[model samples]
Target chain A: MRLWLPPVLLAVLLCGLSAGMPALEPLFHWVQPDKQQVIYERESFLFLLQNHLLLVLISAAVGTLVAVAGGIFATRPSGRDFLPLVSQVASIGQTFPPVAVLALAVPVLGFGEAPILVALMLYGLLPILRNTLAGLEGISPAVKEAARGMGMSPLQVLVRAELPLAGRVILAGIRTSVTINIATAAIGSTIGARTLGDPVIAGLVNGNTAYVLQGAILIGLLALATDSLFEALERTWDRRFSPQVAV
Target chain B: MSVSRSESSQLMPNRVIPALGLLALALVWLLDVGTIQPNRIVPGTGHGLVSAVGWGGAALVTSTLAGSILLAFLNLRGRYLIQLALLGLSLALLPLLLDVFASRHLPEDSPFARSSIGAGFWCLLFFLFLMLIETLGRLGSRRGLELLLVVVIGGSWLIFLQSEGLESLSLVREFNARPAKFEQAFWTHLALAFGAVAISAVLAFGLALKMMRSPGWQRPILGLVSFLQTIPSLAVFGLLIAPLSALVAAFPVLETLGIRGIGWTPALLALVAYSLLPMVRNTFVALTEVPENLADAGRGMGMNERQLFFKLKLPLALPVIIEGVRITTIQAIGLTAVAALIGAGGFGSFIFQGLGQAAMDLVLLGALPTIALALLADAVFTMLAASLKPTPATA
Candidate 1:
């Protein structure tokens, strides 16, 4: 199977379902025969999908940048003293569940998109930070020495040698971070951020099975599509870079 | 050369403690240490460090932080021990810091008046703990020592909270109102999270064993579990409700047994489904990765396949399997909170209820315990895995 095929297929299906959801009213009517309104109409599916994707994307971008920078600094000579604490914090912080983090944020930051975004960014950064630290530290000393022997400065070695070697691991970290943020952002609707979870929360609040099914199907497809995209990206990175490492 | 240089640098003044100290000092003076509320719903007036705890408290806080920084810079022999002692004392005494604020500022006129911790106190506590953790790491402390420190600090805080001095604190006040309900929520949360973990562990072990015996079953099984995992928890819970309700409708006897479309039934099913990926993956990897030579040695010693399987592979696999349990338990505890939306009783019910009521304190009452539980699970499982691992010499 082609690497890109699955994600593309999933994406198309997700889009089609979101766009054509109202067209399937008869089917939903069968599912919820007692209900007068079988379909959720508080917010359009496409709009919620966009809002959800935007939240996840923005958080993933900011989290990747901040976590990567912090990871880099901790591994550097000047910041080495902070390494133990930083790495410890990264690992320990993850033990606090994302939902708990979201709940805690509302008290400090107040409810709405801001608190959820802050929570998502903070919580989502952990796995990425951990991966970044591990990737950078796992590089062989001999490899660094070789880079230095070839007249690379510390910065040059870092930019050229360290980062390239660590990039795959860092990407994997971002994948994990994005995967988590997607789910958390869906739950963010409860805290008042418009997301795909809105319909499901609405459905659950009122006895509407059709609404629940719509949201669940979309969220599931989005996750699948995003995950496959990452898989394809990782495969491409492996193909391009594994040859160099092997030599 | 680099190794010696790195070693020598270890003797240099520690940066982490001082950095944390300076930041905590700034935050304590800069932000409000506590707030005074008229009642549960009313927003409170925040009091800064000096105003809230008075000059004596402020002076004491400043000196302690400054002393920590000084200690970090002193380069004395066994400074980590000194730092650890100082930090641990400060952390254990932290609740009393709030007690001081509560006593100083709480209105005597209104019984409804309550005190809540402000951002500054949280910052101070957080930094102190961070500094303590850094100190512990620097000391290369044993797990036993770390656990003892936690127990000591945790015990002190528990004792202090139970005392009358902190009764006006919002979190405690929230707890006092619904003590029975709180207990029920605690038990319900534990039951759902652990119940799912227990069930999934058994199912995963069977699945993993099957995968071990037959390669063909591996991909599909893993694929199915991973697919389940990738879906959001809310989506899974939502999806489970329809089918479950239909089943209950179809079979009226199911309702008597407490199997319903919504509630713990769907919650547990969703949790178990979500847990399979980690549990199965870990068990499979652990069993497969057991050294072959050890198995041959067991066979040579006249052990039968069953004996060798249990004695060799299972023993070696136990730690990794426990690690999976660690991961699964943490995930389940969190998801169980989400399950409250489906009428499943847990800490999450408190969270969503609080969220609905727009009660920040109530939210804190819910969220804090959930976090504590997850952290506790993490620590317990980590220790279990560590203890179960074969030491280097034995391996």
Candidate 2:
């Protein structure tokens, strides 16, 4: 229960801040004294927040499924021949800057949510795939052999033994993937995706510090909320799975 | 031995390379290989492989793919070596194919007319590179061979891109328009990315030392740095604006020193902040993970603590520390591009400006170099780390 507290509090703060941004106009006026309209009015902070979350959520779901499946395939005996290339691709793909990937998508797919979605999915999968490989490969051959000796089939052993053992690291990979997707989704606003970055980009263009601050605070809070949620999850996983290990 | 030989032979016909070959063959004919534009803003006419570069070029591409696929079925000794040579040659000369496309399809009369790479060309280049990686891995090639390949191919592309035939390529045209700005962006990007890495390396070293001396300090410092990293780059840049502008307002002297609210200052701060997690974590682990016996041996030699650190521990830790630097440098290069949003003036300025104007080639002009810089940094630092590692027997 205590482990869950931080994430809950952070989520509440994120929601409160997003909904209450307009009420703080007097404060924003002080931040930007010369501007006639200090508050960002083109889009509501809540709607932008929702859109940003939807983009990240959809990409994260699809990226996880694809990356995990790819990792499993590469590790299996049937797909063993491709493991080297797959791992190489996973690591090398990360060297690409996410912003460059996002930019490149615009030329090929044009400006819209679709391009950003594809970019997020592709970029987000790399880290997850790398971690999935690392996690699954880190398991010892002896463990699998023992499971086989116990008369369990390969599919049964994989589902019952291998995946459970690798789940913690896979969760860590998901955490990393989500964190990056959040940041990239914010930048997606520049490519015509409606996101929290809308206010920040608009503020930068118009030289309105208030709008910038509002967007920045919300983005910062969203990231914090998401990170803390992952922290609580990792702690729960650790406690439930590895009670013998010290924190 | 006989059973193992049989099993290995059964696995002989490599499936990955042939599959990639088939995909490339399809894409090269199915998709546009290049596009010819009359001007910067308008959409261009798409050209297939034969239309863009003639049947000769088309035959050359088809033959390369067909040959790579055919070689996989040969079951001959040293097959991977032959495949490597063939693919490496093809990859090294890929830019000339584009040059051919530009020379053939580009309108000679219109100064504004330019040609850009299309999906098929990108697919061909990508599939060829994948095949090369597979072949290299199968051959268990030496690091020297890989480096030689990179240098040869990179040099070839540089020469071809700068050649007269490709002058009408849209990416080249964009660079030609603002050569001075391109140079400045290059320098600014190098300075900002490396500057942040250097600063954080020193600060993280100090922090790591402190954590080593007092274990209680470790959690709080790591926590703060990771927290800084979790915030999006734009938000960090945005968050820094208010306080920085207010500070400059309060201290007018900072304006003359070029410390603004939204330029390189905030960018440097944010980059340095983000760099700390990897830098400190690696430094701390590297220093602490040094074997205890080595230090005792140094003490047995009557060396003081400082001498033991400088002579024994630091040298052992250097490779891991350099590994951390590699990660930080690649990350900083990417973030520096994002920092352009806050007026830091790097390659990202070109990306954003191009996006604003809907100029795809200009965006490539920014993005391609950033990716190249990252790949270069990755290669250099990887080599440096490998070279710094003490051999197992010696250690």
Candidate 3:
């Protein structure tokens, strides 16, 4: 029930801002010129929200696939030697900022979603990869031995025992990757990929506080919603995994 | 038996990867025509690699092919020397290839007809990178070989910097055009990154200590910092603009002190805000991770709360705290580039300008230096964290 509070509050704030509530006008009053006021209505909030969600979803899905593949490969007997290399590559991926990636990628991939997608995927890779690796490596050797003793093949053990145990941690990584990508995706607008960042960029350029606030508030709400949803999912996972363990 | 199998497999040279790489490079050079193109002045009308570099290019290609063949035959013991030599030769070929292409294809006075690095060039670079990685893996901890390679590469880069062959490259031209501006931007970038780190360290440490003392404040303070972390940097910059402007308008004195809606003031504030989470979280974990028995022992010895904190908690937590500092500093350095969007002067100015101009080299000119700075900061902080770490007690 407490989880609903954030979204409810966010909805109310959005409504008030969209309605241009007199109470909220003072918040943006400083942005006005002498004896003049301006209201921002440049882009549709719903459209921006959808665009932002789409970018995050696409990037997170791709990043998850790549990171999980790399993570799984590194944990394998033959591939264990590549763990340090994989980890270093992922860290370097993160160290280069998403904006720098966008800047560099724009030339090769050209502008729009391609470059932004590349940036977000690279930016989102580290958390998912690191967490996935950690989660897999954290599994006890006893569990593996037990599964093997029960006549399970390596693949069967991995699927039935190992992955299930690592599921929550991997899910947490995906959650972190997706949530961070939500904010980082805003940079996509700089390279002509329209998202919630349009207003933020527009406001920065034109000095329209209303536009900035509107975009920021919507993005903040979206991030909060995503975070809370992940929290709820985590709680559910926890409940399922250990009924005896108290919340 | 498994160990022997693995050891034997490891000892056998992995020639396939490097050979495959060389094959790709050879195929690109031979079959993939139009590898060198005139800089995209009028879209795409450039000659093939052979015509671009003429006879000298063929000789260079043959040499590289021979080197790769030699690399495949050589055992692990003697491979490092050959790999190092091949790597140096490959590095030298880049500028030579460019220079030859420019001289052959483009007329001397036709500035617009400059040679551009093409798909073939990129393919060669990819091959070189693979070879370097493979060699590094095989060489293991031959520190002397690594040092010699670095010195050779560094010396070659220095020579490349002075050579006119690189003059036609757009990145060099951009640098040559605005050397002073680039210098200023570099310093400004350094200042913003380091200055923000210094301020955030103090604030984060104070908040962390406060949160440690008061359990009630922990949830709210940590939540707030985490929430702030979620705010995209641009949005944070935007959010700060109005309030900061209003503050300057109201105070008037702040404006005199160089506080304004846009620039370093907001950039620094946003950076400090972003930095607080990692710093506070690390500090909190570090402080808590210190054994309760130690603190209790300190208290039992008649040490006051202040003494317990200063003498026991802090010293124990210092390494982790320094780790946090390292993380925050590296993060801040990377982020300061974004701060340029808000009129704050930094390397980002060049990045954005390059973006506007659609100049890849200009973007690189801004970006390369920023990446170098982040790496430098990372190395320095890593050393600091290592030196500060408490050594394990002898048995």
Candidate 4:
């Protein structure tokens, strides 16, 4: 029963914010003189929300797969020597601003989801890769040796023992990557990829504070909701792993 | 042991393999293919390709080829001095090669017909980078060699700055057209990056210390900062606009003080906010990571809490705290580029302008400098942190 609290709370908060946006119109009017009571008219909140989520989901999914694969490959005996190089490349990817990536990608990919996806994937790759690498390395060698002694193959030991042990850390990485990308995906609107950033960009351009507020509020809510969901998952994983019963 | 010695002697630095790959690419693609092509406004316009041989770049090409061949022979010898000399020659030759290629190939009177650098130049630059890394790796302890390389590179760049040939390059053309604006943007970028770092560092230090004193405040403060971190810079800029404007409206004094909704005030605030997480997290970790036994020992010496913190904990944590500052400062430098979106002038203004104009070189002009700044910041902070680290004897 306690597990449902976060989602319920997030839903209520988001719904309230969205519904109350019209009432808060006067507050936004303080930003510009002409628009006394106006709401952002770019796209409906729900539609923008869906678009934002889809962008994040696609990027995070692709980013996680590639990063996890890279992480695993680097940890393998034959590939261990490349770990530093791989990590360095990942760090470089993170350090390059997503906006810059977007600017560069737009000319080649055109102004659309493709460029945004590329930028988001590159931006989100580091956390997952770093955490995955750390998680794999953190595994006690004795645990692996015991598994091998039990007649498990290397592949079996990795899939059944190693990955399961590393799941929590890897999940945390995915959470960080996904949540960060959720906010980042907003920047996609600058290049005409329809997302929550549309209102913000529009407000910025047209001096419509109401539009910016609407978009920012939604993005903030989305980030909070995703973060709470990850927290809930972490708690569940903690319960499953710990031997001691909950009080 | 003999086999190991032979292998070690025979093997070139690992970086050379990639260098060789780049050289191979240069040989196959760049030698026959165009080194520069006339930039076209219309898509798919048949601009004539100017190969290195056709563009009077044969001297540079021949030299580079000969240098690579020499490197291959010297690789087996594996002597550090020979490698260093060869590396120095390659580094010195590269800028001259670029200068010659640009001067010889690029047309002077045609503003419309810009000569874009082709695949060959890119391949050669990559090759040079690989060589530089390999040479640096081999001469790891020779800081003088690294300094010499920097001086040589800077000297060549200065020469390029005054060269008539470089004016034909699109990036240089962009700079020449708006030199004053470029200078303004550069200084603005530096000021914003450094100002945000300074403010955030102070605030972060105070907050971190407070959190340390009250253990319960740590989690909430960290959580808030991390939450701020998760908010995109664009969103933060958007969020600030309304409230900031309201503040300005209420107090005309702020407007008089240069506070506005879409400029430096909001940009600085956002940059400082974004910077706080790294600063706070680093300080918190550094403070907490101080060994309990060390603190106990200090206490045993009759030192009070203030003395213990100032004398022992701070000195030990200084390096880590500086590391935090480094990360925050670098991150701030990058984020300041995004601040240009809000009318806060920086290098990003050029980037967005270039993007609007659909000029790739102009984008590179803005982006290249920003990247250089970030890398420079990283290098400087790394050196500072290394210097601050206690020696093994002291530890």
Candidate 5:
């Protein structure tokens, strides 16, 4: 039922971004390399796009590893101590705006992807970490006891038993993180790495809203599309183990 | 679930970690001072106050130690005396650390580095000390209320009184010394924040209520808001510019209506759009969470939907609704600063100025307030949230 809203809206946004853009390419023909290329290079939008997959993949990969590990530790009585610390830290990340992180990071990392990466890492950690913690904790102890009594190794039990059970929730967290990462990545543009936010910043300066519109709509569409895709994935995963709904 | 007994037991006086960390840091310092048996055994002090990683490590260790100390203290007597002693000791150590680092030739003028490093140490200590105190006697209790009144009145008075000499604070000085242009810039920045929050609250509540009461509309509204949430703030600004420029141009009346380019109108609109989803989503979830039985009972008792919504659903959802506003408020303040990129002004005045001039101080003027604003907003909202909680049945 929820499948259509995001993608359809995204398509409309992306369509307007590309098709409705003003024909300013000809106006700047005489100065510098073509406007598009010059803007592309200057804004470094291409550079960000070039690194987009790597950024998303790395953030997701590390997030998955830490979150899962943290989740395991969190679910145990003995290892429960770190949960408050990690979640508190996560809330701090959300509460303290990304601009603050970017400001603080500038001196240490000295700008570019390092600042973006660190901010993104902090921003992305919460959902995945919290959800991993939540998902594992949500599992009934009886289910785990039954598995343990059957002689499943801890590793096997986690991988073949608990993880599958927690997959849907964990994936939801990843989806949250991913969508958040895209928005945080726009802050990257403010610092000069340039992703979808380049045109938006340019538009602000030029007083041409379309440029901002173009980039914003694309990024929005990207986030929505990705989110919708993840939601679809979530449903599919949820259905696999829940027999009543699966049939 | 309650924490284990092991968690509670760790709160006792063996708060050995901070003392040991300080000892290790001192040892490192002595070696760096050429006072050690083996030079390698002496940790070399890095230029930026014991090095970045070391500072961060020390902070983490100290925070944990502090946390453990608080845990231990809650079950002890004379906790205030204990905390006072710890504050005095840390205050005493700070000057020595400052001297050792001063001799090491780190920049004394580096407030960010120094404050951040020092704050890292202090916050963990403060939080550790206060967490137990807070949880043990949280706001609904009589003592808690007294403490609250004292702290709030004291804190507010200090800030208000201090506003007289706000320029004395180095950061605040730069803020005050900025030109008229920056002041103008600040007004626009404030307008954007004020406008965004206002619009977002209205839109969010409207949409939230609409979506919550009707399941048929849920997916689409959630998706729309989610989609709105996904849009880059910068892009929203970009998208609005062309259409708005033309619309204002056609009307001419709108310019008189206070519509302007790359200024308050569009920035406010962009921020409003950005801030909406969180509030809407939060309010809807909060309201819908009202017990189904209660709502059904209300209807059974002859309460119509409107009456029920106003009297019951709203009051119950107030806490979460306020929470969502808190998030949006913090976010809007930060985003409002970004509106400076378009020449709509506020603290972003200093941020964009600093960016332009490559002057970090200018950036700090804007950036620091923002951080403070966010923290203050969070603290105030959280306090309010505490007070709003239903009174516990003392029984």
Candidate 6:
């Protein structure tokens, strides 16, 4: 019998069967209806989870568009000189601390979700940008020239000729951005953006180790799950679309 | 050479137009800030003709820039717009540096305190104008200019944070400030972590060199390092605590040798351990790709293995090794921020402080510096890697 360790464990983590989401609220809260004292509800937990996921998806989608376009730009002759510039810019995005990025952008964008989205997008850009550049550069010039000589449009060459060849490397970029985004999304929750980090942050403050564990494990599991899933998708994509790609 | 100079000179006017455009925009912001009534707290102002001018000017500048960028894309214009932007930014920062960082350090109510805005504009504008001129000037290398800009930006901030920086400068001050908890707290944790990575870099370099020469040892060691990286950084820290604690118990000397704890020591050691795989693997790859025929030629010349490793392989491998270092340093910076989770502190002092207080501003104070540190480290690495490559003149 074949045993699948990663899938089995990942499933358990996601199901919150073996490990559960963490507690976020203080031990007591004043109820909205009767002013009676109570703990925070399950509703806040759900809100955090939903917002966290939304931030991740939006950031990653923005990242993909920018990276792919950047990749294409990097492949052009004049843009070739911009590799260092683009890399440096992305690193700045990486370097401009997320909190600082929030501070810097706050005057421009204001509080809450917008700043968080900006942070994740900035952080998410580098790997995707770098990978896109690297992937496109790695494509054989001869193959590209051949595509052009055959009367194929530039778009056609990029889509059918160059991208297909660079799929694996591009996928690697996607993987890096996705994983980084997962960790960074937690930082957003700190700014009232509601994320699984609510529990973790709450737990740490109150010295409630259990609450911390609940948040930490779920977030960790989330990262691991994305990592594994993307990795699988990468492998599958490579096998199907570019059969000749070296594993 | 003569032809190249002529070609570059032809590129001069391409630089000038955009630079002028940026200056014009800066003038507009200046007018806006000067003439507009201030809300003080809100940037870009809340109302009045100045506010209108402030935003209007900003929109116009953005469009001009976008236009310039579009021209570059279309190969019609603005190829030099970017150069001008960096130029303006760098120049503006120099004076702004005086204002932002130096202001509060002065007597609290001094009019000179707000004069930082003047300093800000002067320095920043100078840098911008200089850069635009430089592209036309080719007066200095772009890389040098970029470094100067970063230094101007970061150095000014450092000057601003001297109080905090000086406080954390010494282990003696740090330890004496808290006797019993010396080994467990934030400052010690950061120092240990910083030390761990530095030590690990040296150790990993040696280990990598050894494994590169020996097939039997390389595979297992690489596997171990890769596996180590896969462990959640926190989990690794957790796993390490028990082993470290056990080792300290079994061999008491290890404790006095400066081994210990759920604190900085273990956290740092674990981070270093995580760091090694990338450095070692990168070093190995760099060394191995030195084209075996070069080593064969060295052997034919009767050079000893040691000489060949250093004189040829190491120099050839320097770029990749430095690239690895770049990655390691950034990773270390990020991970170091997490060191706060284990009670070890760098700038994570601000991060946790912000979290506990739920004050986002406080967290930015900590995190911004960490990000700056990471970026600065990346810049340093990039420069090192770039310098290692065979220069065009040499080639």
TM-score each candidate.
0.98, 0.97, 0.86, 0.85, 0.74, 0.70
Q: Which parts of model 6 have CA positions greater than 4 angstroms off? A: A1-9, A16-54, A73-87, A95-113, A241-247, B1-193, B206-210, B213-224, B227-263, B355-361, B386-395
lDDT values, one for every candidate: 0.93, 0.92, 0.74, 0.75, 0.61, 0.59
CA shift of A231, model 4, Å: 2.7
Q: Residue A33 of candidate 6: its Cα lDDT?
A: 23
Q: Which prediction has the highest TM-score against the true structure?
A: 1
lDDT of 5 by residue, B255-342 (tens): 9988975577778888887788888888888988989997998999999999998887888788898898888888898887767676
Q: Is candidate 1 or candidate 3 better by TM-score?
A: 1
Candidate 3 C-alpha lDDT tens digits along B233-290: 7778877887898899899999899999888998989998999999889988998899
Question: Can you write out model 1's per-residue Cα lDDT over B1-395, one digit (the tens) per residue?
Answer: 36465445447799888899999999999999999999988899999999998899999999999999999888587687788999999999999988988898888989999999999999999999899999988877478779779999999999999998999999999999999999999999999999999999999999999998999999999999998999999899989989998999999999999999998999999999999999999999999999989888999999998998888899899999999999999999999999998899999998999999988888888899999999999989999998898766753
Docking class of 4: acceptable
lDDT of 3 at A77: 86
Q: Is candidate 2 or candidate 3 better by TM-score?
A: 2
Cα lDDT of candidate 4 equals 0.75
For model 2, the superposed segments whose C-alpha errors exceed 4 Å read: A244-247, B1-11, B392-395
Off by over 4 Å in 4: A1-4, A11-33, A107-110, A242-247, B1-105, B118-158
lDDT of 2 by residue, A172-202 (tens): 9999999989998998888899999999999
DockQ score for model 3, please? 0.43
lDDT of 4 by residue, B304-385 (tens): 9999999999989999999999888888888888888788998989887776676766776787788778877886887789
**What docking grade does candidate 5 earn?**
acceptable
DockQ for every model, please: 0.86, 0.86, 0.43, 0.38, 0.43, 0.21
Model 3 chain A worst lDDT window (10 residues):
A33-42
Clashes of each: 0, 0, 0, 0, 14, 16
Report the C-alpha lDDT of model 5 over A1-247, residue by residue, as the tens digit: 5655666776565555445434444432322232343232343433444465466667777777877787787666665544555555556556666666566555345557777787677667778888887788787888788789999988787887788778778898998888767766775666755577666666556544435555666666666667777767777776667783233
Q: What is candidate 1's lDDT per residue for A140-178, written digit by digit as tens? A: 999999999999999999999999999999999999999
In candidate 2, position B64 carries an lDDT of 89
Candidate 6 displacement at residue A133 in angstroms: 2.1
Between candidates 2 and 5, the lDDT winner: 2
Q: What fraction of the true interface contacts does model 5 reproduce?
A: 0.50
Ranking by lDDT: 1, 2, 4, 3, 5, 6
